[model samples]
Target: MAVSKKRDKNVYKAPRNIGKPESENPKWLIPTALTMLIVGVVWIVIYYITQANYPLPIANWNIVVGFVFLGTGMVLLTRWK
Candidate 1:
């Protein structure tokens, strides 16, 4: 019986972005900004509606929904990369 030699496997390497110029960065700021803006507007609207309907003395827990949206939008805006 004849023995066959095995070929060496090639290693793959990830491309480096370390030296990439500023121009190569993605231009997602505009779209992200717009999304955040829309979210904020909706949040405010929801907040106002909730405040007006739930109670007069502000003892309701429904305002949390509005705040959740607002906080999420703010976090997205701040953490946009």
Candidate 2:
């Protein structure tokens, strides 16, 4: 007669092939994302320091532009492997 043991119902077992190779990010990914982030920060900083007079004559709209750059950079970073 063969005897078998059952697995614990509450325990979790990971698969053998769990460690897949990491995917490589595109050559432009890092630089572009970093640039966007830096540019966004600088844009906002300048806008504040200049009392909303520089970067763009649009005043409050400059904040929107800066945030857009920041958002784009963040989104790009999420795709990195």
Candidate 3:
């Protein structure tokens, strides 16, 4: 008696598309904005709490950094469609 060999059934197929199209809604916008806002608020609070032990220049720098995050979040929200 003779037996036939079985062919391999496992094979990989290439994707038709390389990347996601721009037409899809970017769902990350809202969550990212919220994160930025929360981070900014936390920075401001930390700066205020430590201001008593730090120099004026350092405190000012922290305030500026916090505002930058808030501003960036606002800008991103505005651009959302």
For residues 1-81, write the lDDT of model 2, one tens digit per residue.
999998788977787767764677899999999999999999999999999999999969999999999999999999887
In the order shown, the candidates' Cα RMSDs to the true structure are: 9.0, 5.5, 9.9
Q: Give candidate 1's TM-score.
A: 0.35
Clashes of 3: 0
Off by over 4 Å in 3: 1-24, 52-57
lDDT score, residue 71, model 2? Answer: 98
Please give, for residues 1-81, the per-residue lDDT of candidate 1 as tens digits: 999988768867677976666463247754766675676567556557776564333444445555655566676566444
Candidate 3 lDDT at 36 equals 92
In terms of lDDT, the best-performing candidate is: 2
The prediction achieving the highest TM-score against the true structure is: 2
CA lDDT of each prediction against the hidden true structure: 0.60, 0.94, 0.78
At residue 26, what lDDT does model 1 achieve? 43
Q: Tell me the tens digit of each residue's lDDT in model 3 across 3-79.
A: 99897788777787756564754899889988898888888887788763432456478788888889989988886
Candidate 1 deviant stretches above 4 angstroms: 1-59
Candidate 3 minimal-lDDT segment of 10 residues: 51-60
